[model samples]
Target chain A: MIQRPITVLMLSGLVLILLIGVTPAAAHGVEITYALTPVQTVRVEVIVHDLAGEPVRKADVTVFTPEVAPGDAPAAAEAELSPWLETSTDRNGWVSFVPDPALAGSWQIAVAVDDADAHITLPLAEESGLIRLASDQGISVMSSGLQVTVAATPITTIQVALHAQFDTGEAMDEAQVVVYAPDNPQDPFLTGTCDAEGRYAFAVDLGRPGVWEIQVRKAGHGDWLKIDLDENAIEFEEVPVDTAGDADSTNTTVQTVRLADEVARSVESDDGLSSGQIVLMSATTIWGFVGTALYFSRRRAATRPESESDN
Target chain B: MPRRFVTLVLIVLLLSSALIALAQAATGTLEFYANGEDFVRQGFVSKDGWAISFDHVYVNLTGITAYQSDPPYEPADEDAELVFDVEAILEGSYLVDLAEGDEDADPLLVGEVDAPEGFYNALSWEMVPVEDEESDMDGYTLLIIGTAEKDGEVIDFTLGIEQSYTYTCGEYVGDERKGILEADDYADLEMTFHFDHVFGDGELPPDDGLNETAPGFAPFAALAEDGVLVTDLAALEEQLSEDDWTLLVDILPTLGHVGEGHCHATLLDDVGETAE
Candidate 1:
């Protein structure tokens, strides 16, 4: 009986080991957190994660402080004087930065995983004096860094693949990607979830040849990236000229404005009756009155003569 | 009383009643007919000495009116409300295709109107293009399919024109041209459209003015035959130059001759009418 229990325990442990081996790792991403202390000093924290949700240790974090106010035209500042503050994440995937307590304007923080190509802009509000996330698509709050491209076209079949990443160049998993076709665009053509390596793909047969728009988004993110594709070309910019016919057909809405004003004005100005018209009008009126007078007089003459002859 | 006095009184009363009846208002059917019905059926010779026949001619005849006053009947103000007491003829789009010679297709209805029985000095018509989305047929405002042949050399031409024509009889009145509306009667306002005038002398633009070979119009033949054509206002505006487009729009309405396009009102009982 004891041997049987021991065998059952061994099998259970083996099944647990197999389960752990099969489970996917967390998606590669970055997270930044910040809080203000009672002393009015601000401390910013940065955390990096691998695809398996494990901490990514020793990633470099760079911080840029702005000389002007937040929400102002970035170009008007002319130059940023503050030197970049740099540090690396510790063993627990955490990095800390302390700004001068007297300096209280906006600050732009950036994180670089390894090389300068993989950099992300961390979210910080200049006025709120609080560190907040600008985007939730990946570790970085800025989603504008994502690059999208189409496969190929003449589009017998529609297929699109997206690589989700932060501005810092870290791959992001679990991001939502949706594809929309020209026809039935109100509904999604297909929806996909990113794999461990921060990649999502979709494919379907399309019926029409026109512009197809795809949207990529992450949870808690307000805005998403939009990509357009033409059936005849791999890129939207290379769309064929003949495809504009569909656009021509759609611009046929009825223009309710009357189209004859200019012609009427010209006719009126050139040949419309002026003084002669008045004479004709007077003639018509006089003739009408004359006819009435003649009728009344003839009736009176005939009636008077008849009455006189009878008397 | 003497018989002579009684007869005189009766005669006077009869004369007054007749005068009153003649002065009273009357209603009639204002009929519109094209002059080239027979020519459309049988091929007619063009001015270029070529035989030509039309396959279709569609026009939207709307906003018909008759004015009792003289010419220069206050230039039409599109935005102005209907203040002048003008007698309206047609209320909706009236289609007159000479090719469709069936019983149901003859004598297109202008409208049923009630007006004083007299001569209306001015008659006006507003002909706008047929829009595709609003119409069941092909969006061609005017589609003319014909063949011109000279010396055994044949040229098949198809022209689609989309333009709005607003014209009044003021400029077209001859010494005796007038429209008469009688009580419960049928009258034919014959507005004859001369296709020859459109392609007159086969000259190009700035020469013949409104010809098939005009810059914006020549492309219509090929596009229509290919079964991919839309001649809406915007399309024409885009295709034609400013001068050519303006020239075509200005000259098209003056194509009909006065007598050919004048009104000829007839009594309903005079002939048994065969109209739909």
Candidate 2:
């Protein structure tokens, strides 16, 4: 009986040895990790090793972004990945993948090695802002060949004066002029060119209160001006003008004084005038007269010399 | 259990032994042979209708061990004047009587054997006329005799003869003359000379410049058999126009010369076609 038991033990030992001899050694699975950046790309690296810590070769590997719940599988899982983005390691047993236009926000990456699996979650962020646009001087003209202005006060009624002069410095009869309000540039508040003496004037009614831009354009030349208006604000508060002088001798002074007054009045009124508008109007009136006078004077002078020579 | 293990080991050993024995039982063998001596003969009719024969005969004995005489020629005694000195004999020739085969067959004569002197140590039999007309049916025959002995004395020997014949005639066209102008109705004409080398030499002579009084050697210059000079320009013009003689004549000078040593001629129906 004892011999039988001994034989059974020996048989059992032999069976154990055979099973152990056939058993396969454990294989170390690969672990892959990824880092992503906006405007750049995400990089994935795979590391493979055997149970003995020796690098293994010919290990089939694949990597891709995982699908989300209740949705179709990600396209990347089914498509051929870019060569630069997908790479297998040389005999050394290392592989890497980089996502072009790196994924934004959270992304899950899955990596498989010789049937084993592993994954990593990557968080990507986009770099912040880079572009802007604004006006240079507080006010700008629209495309209609006119002037515009922002204002602090409401402009109720605005009056523009007229004056004229011939090339010989002699005053003339009539002139044409055109003026435009910011609200309606196509329809001018005033229209006409300078008359024989080169002078013009007009007035406009402010429909409502707010910043208004006035535009002054020479008829034939298409030259124009734009000015911001804040009716509640003061204009000539910055300029010192001499208001005492004979209107005739002071014409030059008056021109300057009137411009200053307009500016002040425009600013003080419910619809304040833009400093730019006051300046442009004053300059236009004065220069219009001066240009006409200079032109005629030179013409007369040139004719006189020719006539004299003919005589 | 131990007995069972021992029995299993014996079974594997026996199986392997059987497998080895089976592998050794299969066997195979291979063999090879060299080509034998060969020869061929051909015949053709010349453009001028003369019977011509071309014989290309060779002996291949790299592996043959013996040889024998062909056709009418039997082995001659050692003292015979025309005894074939195999050591000195490289080639041989014979003539066939073509008339025996058909009444209309042209006569074929063996004129001579032109072989390099000293190449062969013996002079074979004279040109014997074979009585076999059946043999001449094809206008040619090849006969080979010799033993292809590599390292031993010559043994069994026999002769092989292959005969062939081509009924078409062989013709030669000469170079054409350029820049010949004639009246519109007087189309240019060309003369072609044709002959067969089997007629021996001097059948045709060199060409002399036009207008020369000497009789020209051109075939068209003289009628075959009669040797009459064709000098009538009107008749020549009529023949030329009938055969588009102008074209043929123009291309005659450009056909250059054909055949080595011998000359022949052909009249082209259209010289322009020939030139193109």
The best candidate in terms of lDDT: 1
- lDDT string for model 2 (B137-182, tens) is 1221223222222133222222222212111111111121111111
RMSD of candidates 1 onward, in order:
32.2, 55.2
User: Please, what are the lDDT tens digits per residue for candidate 1 over residues A30-113?
Assistant: 221111111112344556655455665766554444443343323222353223344566787666544433244455444445
Give a tens-digit lDDT track for model 1, residues B144-223.
66565557655565555554455454212221223555566754455555444443333223433224322323333333
Q: Give the TM-score of candidate 1.
A: 0.32
Badly placed stretches (over 4 Å) of model 2 are A1-42, A65-86, A127-311, B1-276
lDDT of each: 0.41, 0.26
Question: What TM-score number comes out for model 2?
Answer: 0.14
Give residue A297's error in model 2 in angstroms: 99
In Å, residue B275's CA in model 1 sits off its true spot by 36
Rate residue B106 of model 1 by lDDT: 49
Q: Indicate the docking level reached by candidate 1.
A: incorrect
